[model samples]
Target: MNTTEIFLIAILVIFSAPYLVWRLGRTDYWAPLVVVQILCGILLGPGVLGAFAPAVYDHVFAPPVIAALNGIAWWAVMLFVWVAGIELDLHQAWANRRETGITAGLALGIPLTFGALAAAFLLRWPGWSGPNARDWQAVLGIGMACAVTALPILILLMEKLAILREPLGQRILRYASADDIAIWGVLALILLDWDRIGRQLGFLIAFGVAAVLVRMMMRRLGKADRWYVGIIWLALCGFGADWSGLHYMVGAFLSGAILDAEWFELEAMDAFRSVILLVAMPVFFLSTGLKTSWEGGGPAVFAAAALLLLASVGGKLAGVHLAGRILKWPRRETHVIGWLLQTKALIMIIFANILLDKGIITSATFTALLLMAVASTMLTTPIVAPMLRRLGGA
Candidate 1:
């Protein structure tokens, strides 16, 4: 529990966690790594192991340590956002895919309606002393939280399961990409000052122009050196966005999506992915886990937690189902896609952290939302995968 020991543990975790994941992938127990990673954190954190070993927990999760952890979390999110952008296939979805439009509408509409209703009730309820429950900001934040679709989790699952190339998978990715852009746009409008929108739009236009220039510049660079340059550029974009009052992940995502569209072949993309995923993302995930305090207050908290979970699950189902019907898709495909899209993870955490940082939601609410995310992810993935298999689809 001393300073020396703390440093060692930090080193061990940083160096070993990803190695463990890689090794586990070669064994029969590979699927459990995600659960194990979080569970290990819970045990070694304030929940159980820390309860029994307070000094160790204090030494490890100290204020300085927590601050460092938050840095890692932000970095991890940026990596994930970068990967998200790289995965974008702009023209993949049929331009007239009724399924795309309908499914997306359902995804957004169901959550917005359900979230607003849920927030209205939560605001009126007792407990929740952390913030002014009735604040319009709280309602906006919660509504947006409920409306989130974890596009990264979807992409990861689709890729890991080797279904990324499937038609349904392509549809999900295409629809999800469009949906992600729109959702962020909606989030910006909800959160930004109305006067800033024009400036924000201007910055985006300029960023697009800059990206083209950067791509052309990169084309003249040596193949092995573009990655180093890309890192510098990524950091600059992140800095620019932060300075402009935009979130860091937005800059990272934009940089990524822009790169994806720049006619880079698989080799350049692969190199880019290696740096972002191998080095950056694990740090981000560990940081996110460390910042999050899963255990919260009393019975009222638990009730609120349950409601959040239900809203996340139920809202997605309602939205996807209605979208499918509108598009005249098969009932089973519609049902599968509904469940497939509900498992919120990476992007939800990124956006939720933004709300938490802005004081729009309390730490307790963020914790509850995290729990809702983990629960939905664990359940939805297994459930949807089997359904996809049954339908002889992805």
Candidate 2:
């Protein structure tokens, strides 16, 4: 078959297999459609599918086909990340800085510390850190992965729980929003290239100046024009960042971060997000899965994943519990918040993806982080639902 035909087949498989499992299996209670989609990607990847059926894998994921799909995945994730950046309720976070700071600080910091220690242990073994990575970069990359709270995924979960607009839910959004900024900042730091330091600094200055002009134009533009201009801005920023060795995703996030969510209609923004997820993000997920490797052995990867999970979950709960004490929050509130805050899902996967792209972590480490994220996200609803009910009861 031609590359287009093969790519179409791949796309069909990407959307179909996940939907069937998510719908027919009725796994939504334990695993949301998003989580299932991610797992399906892993199963469809070279590690599982290629191992079992190399011939079929090669046919479907031919070199040309893979290239085409990768292009789609890159843009899809860029738009997705940009939307997440735009949706960040920074105004709300700043308004309630004290509580947001305490909760967000502990929520991110403790997991990062635990994850770093876990990474330190993993460093004793080979095949975890990527070839281009420094020891410090590997440790910091893994640690930040554990600390990530996928703001987009967290928002989806809150919507699922019917509390997205509730006071508690909004509170959670504030905390996650603050952490989102930090996560990207850490990514920029991790991706910093000393050889390209001048370019990076130039990118920052150019970005600041361009951002001001864009903001000025946005304020004067019609709502419809804003969307078009915003996309153009996304592309330009992505270009600038990539040229500077900071990665285009960094630019994507920054482009959206500067925009006010209110610039567009709420319903339109929701529809846009939904459309992007339905149409494009499956490609990104599949691309991620295709990169998964068991070169270090499956058992080792799973073990590392388990360790990261323990660190991520344990640290998040500990930090939140500490914050609860200081803030005088109820015990039930702490429990619910902790589990919910620990939700990893897409953001951590995205974080790990960046690490892999920068050669800071190997595929084995990426697989481990991916598994840890899925497991962490799966635990959130199951654990938080009951605790939330108890809070409601009280």
Listed in order, each prediction's TM-score against the native is 0.83, 0.99
Residue-level lDDT of model 1, residues 212-285, one tens digit each, is 99888787887556656666777777776766666676788778777644445665665665565555555555
What candidate 2 gets wrong by more than 4 Å, as runs, is: none
Against the hidden true structure, what lDDT does model 2 obtain? 0.94
Error of 2 at 91 (Å): 1.1
lDDT, candidates in the order shown: 0.67, 0.94
- lDDT minimum window of 10 residues, candidate 1: 27-36
How accurate locally is residue 117 in candidate 2, as Cα lDDT from 0 to 100?
A: 100
Best by lDDT: 2
Residue 9, candidate 2: Cα error in Å is 1.0
Candidate 1 local Cα displacement, residue 387, angstroms: 1.4
